[model samples]
Target: MTVPIEDVRAAAELVALGLRTGARPTDANPYGRLLERYRSQTLFRDTVDTVASGLGLVVLGAPARTGLVLSTQPGSVFAVRMGDLRSTGMSADEKLIAGLVVLGVAAYAFPQEADLDSSEVKTVEVAALDKFVRDSIERVLAVPGDPESVDGQARTAAELYRRTAAFRPKDRQPGPAKGCTQFAVAEVLGWLVERGAARQMPQLGASTFQLTDRFRLLVADVAGGEALEAMKAVRAGQH
Candidate 1:
């Protein structure tokens, strides 16, 4: 299902807010507004289970591992993963990888991933994943918009991610993921990373991510009251 470009921009901006503030899914930060918006819209209700499974894969990476590398709370991996799969046909498996890519980007944005003390992620092919994520962001941008403004696109991406994460089950395992107890969010994240829409930093924590710079620039281009405010909040956090 295609969404308004402005909406996409708004959504991306919201995620960026979370990134800037180091806000976790469980945090009561302003990012919760994005979640509230999606819940009100009732988007991605049909295939929530699939998306959850995909996100679970992202938490574990391409190959299932003994433990997650990221330091997110128990349900966080699921939120990030599911958020990436919003509104896309990308299956549960595909989304799982996508969520992983989000985690990779998050790690890159922050310095927390380096602290993970796990051997499950020892190798990282950065160049390959970077290219994949860039291509995916471009495709996401290719969607037509009535206004074609930066705010349109940024909101869309942010809200999409927020809704995907919010709709995911908080506890129950949606399905088996690579021999692990995967959820829809993980499955969706896995799908995106594998499909080249996003990239993953496997050597980093499950919460890590690196959205293509192209996606970042697009997000930077948006200029809405709420979007700009969110950006300000992020910038303020950096200091």
Candidate 2:
């Protein structure tokens, strides 16, 4: 079968758009036309998949309304490491806490299976999320057993969080500060916004955020993981 040169060019363009800004079929002009081509033409879709695979990317799916979703394969250039989320001058413990904060956001945003399935927008606030994570840590610690039995990362994050202040000092300069739960949560949320996983809801509040469908897709891929399960257990026990 002779593959049309136009199909290859279109496929490359579509994948490029997905990488650059998350190509949506709902988008105007070329993006919409290319994505529509992807859905309608098997050859074009195959070519797009081929291009993505060559670059170590996986096309998660392309829902008409949501557009093209992509994920990086292990070692892919686009893969975001935990260290990438770390702020400058952060200690190893602080980095762990950052990871915990991300998990907390995911848990708080979609605590139940039904929530994940629904299209309803999920929102989170920094202070509320910090409180929830701290409470979750305490709940886990309260379990009767050797403290060592608890997940090591969770324990470490909890200890660090406990030692940290919940808010920055009133007299301190304005900006994110290390060892402050509010700042930590805010930083993580901001990072999420930058990565297209979430968006700030300025009308709701400066620190409030709404998770995007992209984040939902990412979380769904890891919905069965232990970390999420533990967080979900904490949420379930509360209600």
CA lDDT of each candidate? Answer: 0.37, 0.77
Query: How much is the lDDT of residue 111 in candidate 2?
Result: 82
Please write out the lDDT profile of model 2 over residues 133-232, one tens digit for every residue.
Answer: 8878774444343444435566677778888888874455754465688888998888887677788899998778998887887777663545556777
User: In lDDT terms, how accurate is model 1?
Assistant: 0.37
Report how far off residue 91 is in candidate 2 (Å): 2.6
Candidate 1, residues 1-239: lDDT per residue as tens digits?
77666666555544343233233233254445554453455543212222334434211111111111111334654243354445546554444444434433333332222223223222323333333333334333344445345445444554344333223234555433332223333443455444332356645755333333323322233222333334333423443
After superposition, candidate 2 runs with Cα above 4 Å error: 21-27, 64-66, 86-89, 139-151, 170-176
Where is model 2 poorest over a 10-residue stretch in terms of lDDT?
141-150
TM-score versus the correct structure, for each prediction: 0.25, 0.84
lDDT of 2 at 158: 71
* Residue 168 local lDDT, model 1: 28
